[model samples]
Target: MAIRDDYIKWVILITILYRVGTTNSVCELSVSHGDKLYNFSLASPTWKYPHGVLSEDGFYKIARNGTVLWFQLCDGLIFNHDPPRCFDCQDCGGPSHCGMGCSALVANPLGGYYVCTTIGRSSSTKVNLIDEKNPSMGVVVKISSSGVLTNCSLSVSVFCDSNGLQGPNLLETVGTCDYATVLRHPSGCAKTVSLHGNGLGWFSTLLIIVLCFFVAYLLAGTAYRYFSLGIRGVHAIPHLEVWLSLPHRIQGLFRSLIRRFRRPTQGHRSTYSPVNF
Candidate 1:
């Protein structure tokens, strides 16, 4: 009973670990697309400055027409003061809102701030991120969010650059609310191994762990039986009877199945058949 309980405990541990390791999180920094894996783990919200932007304050800023934009890459924007009020402003100040990437302060006809849009939410990375349409062009990390007040949506495209660590470079603004940008970081480059495909996948790794645990269980159980229980010879092996009988049990099962499925044999044919037509 103790050995069986040990076996159960090990199985439960493996199961929990497998589920936690394999489940995808909404804010995963690494994504696998096609044959290559892109990892943005290096890019986090803790950066002192936004990529490519030279600002004493920790965000990239852009002004076009009457609208001003503040944004960050792989992080939420930092503000010294409260941001302008907008429909999405209620959810502002966090990664799921204006902080995730892009926020816009739009000007009204009367010259007052009209609305704000939190264009990129970190939580959307898992669902919206995709590989570049052209592999040769390199990886593109696209993140977007539906507007809180307007019909428009906001998007930011992060391109791969070998030197992108300086931060992301804002390339252009689309219409009144969207953005295009480039990030030249090594993480954007293609990887030979996938996020889960590094040497072995989660399933394979778990399988190996289970096998190791099983072997350890056998060894430990056998030793206990030999020393503590005074079991002798082959009988000292833990569950020796079960192991020894497994082959014969398997054979019996196969034979039973075969008998169930096999065609019935006809009665022995008469050595001399009756005269045939």
Candidate 2:
């Protein structure tokens, strides 16, 4: 009996945790700033330039002075050519020379190419990606600084354009280290549901939890009856009589409540009754 109770408790706890995790997972795809909520789930997938100038492959690329930079939105960069060893990008790079969201190939004065990655492992699903405050711009998703060099960062300013998939266009290059880009995508727009608004209400959430517990209870009770008490068929259901009469019991309870709160009847009295005396 103790073992069965423990099993039921574990099942109930797991079910509650699963439900809560599912609810929180939805919130992870969005960001809240001030009074607005920006849901970027639509643009969560990896986005790359359709055409490449230097190479036939697709990825955003730009050349400045003698340095060439390559990057992708919402994901890491994939290299089509062999890249040099980068000691700083151990966890963020692969054998194919692909690295996190952005990479740079710089020409050395001594005549060899030096390859390094700037932004490391940025994804839309990651929470707190919009930590940068840009009051003029509605939403900004900035990647955490993890570069081969010090103080290197990437900032993407997202603008609302319901019909635009316009850009990850390079806006500015800050001192050959930091890069800023603008992405005009539909996901930059505010969602109808805000961070603290119009999701499943508390009452509905409670109802779901109660229903789950009730179902679990019934299953556990039924199993116990069948296996431990040698009961079979419909008789295996625990508290079978109580459940069957629950509707009537509920109705009776409501009726009693109504009567308790009902107004009392008032008897009619004639004002002329004193004339007979």
Candidate 3:
């Protein structure tokens, strides 16, 4: 990180040369919250133009809902139209299974599994985390609901996925998410349970609809033809009745015509009759 000449005055005004370590130098910046001032360290092993933006490994941004830590920027709108990202830690605020933080059956950092910190909830609970732009030296401040300011790193165990960079003053950090064991350790917070849906799939729904239609067709023909269901002084569906009685009606009409033709007619019953033709 390199500091430019333009920002020199601001750096001097912001920090008062807090500490000068032999190996790694550290500085302090005061973050204002209303009437109070919160100071966090800005440390780096090497120097670049005296002062600059403290980046990864020395400066980390910390955010949490209850016990779970967060590191990634929740994606913007356009995914399922839901405002919250899948890995959002805000969901873990309350003491309930719904507060398991993230839900992923696998180890996917985005949405594959949930990385939770709790005690005695379960031994098989999965841990999923999101740590992206973690600062190395700078401290991230969090304000409680009562308007009191707090450094989140001091109280919560930051589940980091970085390469060996532990930000200053983090209470406890399980360096890699993989380092967090399932039931191997406890953080006093209880594990949250996740529920999944087992509803019918597309194939099942289609199959059910088809079966219903087939059953309805069979029942309509059989029941309506026999019972008639008090159907009297009203118009009936034409094709329905025809479809029901077509076989019997065709046989009856054919038999009547045959008998008429076989019976003696005017030409056959002629008075002289008996010609030897």
Candidate 4:
């Protein structure tokens, strides 16, 4: 038999005003932030939930159970958590929200809650190549923080999906960091989130289907009765009493009809009349 296309539905993908580090949660606080191996991830808080991953290989949606559901492979990141600096963007336009290139938004490498300026971008092609061949087994993009981000030389912290929070990449400020401090998504990370099923919607569709079948059966039965037995035939049916009575209405009706058609009569005249005797 030809294999039917198996469908597993899930919701994934979102464009960003920031990097994958852009988030508001505690756990995903990367002990930094994996893989030309094409690993996918989101910020820490998302680890307990389902999430999406974009790679040169393809877009894969991880189930809440961490099952890798296949998606299509094409150019570019599906969810660019990294938004480009408005003016600093090169091919920047409506399509360049994550910046004109692949940008990395690292968490405060210097420590404390501050959006990292270590964030930068490089050509997509180059970045993909870096992701493939880098010693860290991750991509290496250009540093375009323009000093908003510190140029780090230390191993930056990173996270993974299959694995929990960990540090693989490095960040060295050369002793500088973005002085601006604000509550920002912790970074030097990637994540895999489990996407849950649309239980409610799926059940609702199933319920509707079952109800439809029941209604169809009722209609079919009614139609058959109408075509086979006309209105007069319906009148010949037993009354409600037949359904709920000691003596059925059908039995009484038959008895009454028989009595109405039959009358008492002499079978034969007497052989001798009184006059003849």
Q: Rate the local accuracy (lDDT) of all candidates.
A: 0.52, 0.54, 0.32, 0.32
What TM-score, over all chains together, does every model reach? 0.41, 0.41, 0.19, 0.22
How good is model 2 by TM-score?
Answer: 0.41
lDDT of 1 by residue, 180-244 (tens): 55545544444345545458778999999999999999999989999999988988888888889
Question: Which residue pairs in model 2 clash with each other?
Answer: none
Worst 10 residues of 4 by lDDT: 66-75
The deviation in Å at residue 226 for candidate 2 is 39
lDDT of 2 by residue, 166-255 (tens): 665465766556666666765555453455666798999999999999999999999999999999999899999999999999999999
Off by over 4 Å in 4: 1-41, 44-215, 227-277
Question: Clashes in each model (backbone N, CA, C under 3 Å)?
Answer: 6, 0, 16, 39
Find the 10 residues in a row with the least total lDDT in model 1: 45-54
Q: Which regions in candidate 1 have their CA more than 4 angstroms from the true location?
A: 1-57, 81-115, 125-148, 166-176, 194-277
Query: Total backbone clashes of model 1?
Result: 6
RMSD of each: 20.6, 17.4, 28.1, 23.3
- How far is 205's C-alpha from truth in model 3 (Å)? 3.0
If both were scored by TM-score, which would come out higher, candidate 1 or candidate 4? Answer: 1
* Model 2 RMSD in angstroms: 17.4
